[model samples]
Target: MTEQLLPENVQTWAQAPLPTAPPEPTPAGRLTIASVPAGHPYVRGISGADDGVVRLRDPLPDPADPDRWWPPVVLDAAWITQNADVVDVVHVHFGAESLPPGRLAGALDALDAAGLPLVYTAHDLTNPQLADQAPHEADLDLLISRASAVITLTDGAADEIARRWDRTAVVIPHPAIVAEGATPPPGRATGAFTVGVHLRDIRPGIDAVGSVRTLLAGLTDLRAAGVAAAGRVVVNDRVRDSDALDAVAALLTDRPDCVLVRRPRVADPELEQEVADLDVALLPYRHGTHSGWVELCHDLGVPVVGPRVGYAHEQHPDEFTAFEPDDGVSLARAVLAALARGTRPGSGERAALVQRRALARVVQHRAIVRAHTDVYRTVVRRTGASA
Candidate 1:
């Protein structure tokens, strides 16, 4: 197939060799980064450091809906062209969900014309919101091909990026989402095995109902086989579809071992508590890329049972359980395996584990921040030399 030419104004490095290894640049004054949607947990976690290496600009509210911080102000070509004088670097994290290819290309052109480099953290290779991968792939084709530097969460993701785009990306670990000094919820009843399933505004990638049914079935099977004397599955969902909501409630109605909790929405505190409260958290995503939720679970010493999609298994083999996606039986067997391992620790031991995990997160997040700071400095230095 003949390669279609980009519009006259669009700039791309698709044919260029992989970027050369960058020399470590010396850090100086605070670098102002215009990170799209700076309020996201991942972005905030990485940038939340006392060391003044990077200062991120707060994302402007959405023009259409003033309550949200999406469709970031920096995404506008006019905004970038106007604000480029102040933004040292434009780092894109999560606000590319709506941009078409031509518009994304225009944003890149604006950044280039203004002499501002772009640093894109490839959070999602396949956008969770979209059912189709083509549009997202096209968007990445332009963005990844032109980004001055690209960052991703896992080595597996980086390898995939290299294979797909012929571009090299730095692998930076995801930072902790839970705040430091967070207290895990009070332990469950002694000798009780409990798992949590959260269906918060289900995404296209997730099969929430199927996953919940699988969990209930798995727990029921485990109990019947004497693998466990008693087991519980706690489900949390918000005020959404009335019928879907009723179905969940009805499924658990007769099953005394299973309980469904309906709330308006999951606030941050509740989210943290939910992680701490679960002996295990079940993830039902059949297809997707990476996860901040899994990291959050890890931060609180909660093990996750995610599907065998994306790099979740590769990200932390020992810490997570991967089951064949779309197979309720496979998911049931995986949960049973987790139960067969052993009972959760007592309060004293649990406290110690929580402390250890929390401390590890602190060190990991700081290191991640330093690594990103290095990347920013390197990109700025290279941009300066090229100009």
Candidate 2:
């Protein structure tokens, strides 16, 4: 039978067979990463306690300007030409959003010319920044097809890659972001049910108004059913004049139960506190492949009511409740279910439990680092032998 043709943008070799070979020895010594926002919680948490096998750090383009760390120079063909020797291998966690497909292809060609291996963690199958996924899809196809090895956070995402691109990706769960030794928030006060939804500048995939409206309706139902004596839905967003923000402002005028916290932007500590204070947090994403936010909420001992759009529920089934996409009624029902379950356990026992869980999570992260290191070694070795 003749092989069917793929789209112009889809990687041609995605359907190719894998070579059988003995496993390569694990790569050792300082391994640096060129992750977008190298200091992001996800990247930083990968080291887990202090596993010296991976010396992961994002090389700053400008030492003084932290913002310059993004759109990482490692992805530049010219930069890779000069600096491929600086790092043993290039592992791309992110930073493809800003690069055009042509630029990314150039970077891949540079890596090939330099005889340097490339590893990509498929963090976002669909970029939430763009409503239209074509560009991102094309970019992902190119990267996945050319990558030395691919890694993903969830089985669902891995399956999608296999189905769409005919490539198998190693599945690794995202690491917990909460500090291993950090303290968990005190349990909720008696009779108070606090559910939070963050609407930050009305990001593309978030239906902020729809989420808020659902939560408000849910709160009303919970109070009427006597499941909650008192309820408060804390909605945090950057103060902006958008349809979502306007609707929130109008809702605040009519509803005394809702508290709208307006801030220009929430810092890491404050964001963590916002999730820590809630009985349950709602993630209002219309579409996403997975969520580090859900992992963080779990680490903080807060359950998440997330949309069924992606693998948020799979990330932590115990801590996540999924509602149908854009279905206000489903979300309302999920909220009520969370309220009926009551607040998380008290500080003493629960805090101790969380601390133990945090330690386990640290170990999990170390394993992830080790796994990536293994892949790096395999790719570098195979490429070297071929050379």
- Quantify all predictions' global Cα lDDT against the true fold: 0.67, 0.67
**Candidate 2 at residue 205, lDDT?**
67
* Residue lDDT tens for model 1, 1-387: 000111222223111122122223335566777777676666777875564555544544323433455445567677777666556788888756554346677888999898888999998898766667887888788779999999999999999999998989999987776776666554444456667777665556666666767777777766776655233333345323456556666778778776676565556766666556667778767578887778767666667787777887766667778776555567667776655442363455556767787888878878888889888888989898221
The clash numbers for all candidates, in the given order, read 0, 0
Candidate 1 minimal-lDDT segment of 10 residues: 1-10
Identify the runs in model 1 with alpha carbons over 4 angstroms from their true place: 1-28, 48-50, 59-66, 229-250, 326-329, 340-346, 385-387
The worst-scoring run of ten residues by lDDT in candidate 2 lies at 1-10
State residue 282's C-alpha deviation in candidate 2, in Å: 0.9
Measured with C-alpha atoms, the lDDT of residue 120 in candidate 1 is 93
The TM-score measured for candidate 1 stands at 0.84
lDDT of 2 by residue, 1-387 (tens): 001111222232222222222123335554444454455566676654344444434545445544444445567677677655555577787667655447688888998998888888898897766678888888898889998889899999999999988999999888877766667565544446677787665666677776777777766766676655233444445423377678767766767676777764656666676677677788878777777778777777777787786677889887777776556567667876765553454546446656767888867877887876677668868887221
Displacement of residue 314 (Cα, Å) in model 2 is: 0.6
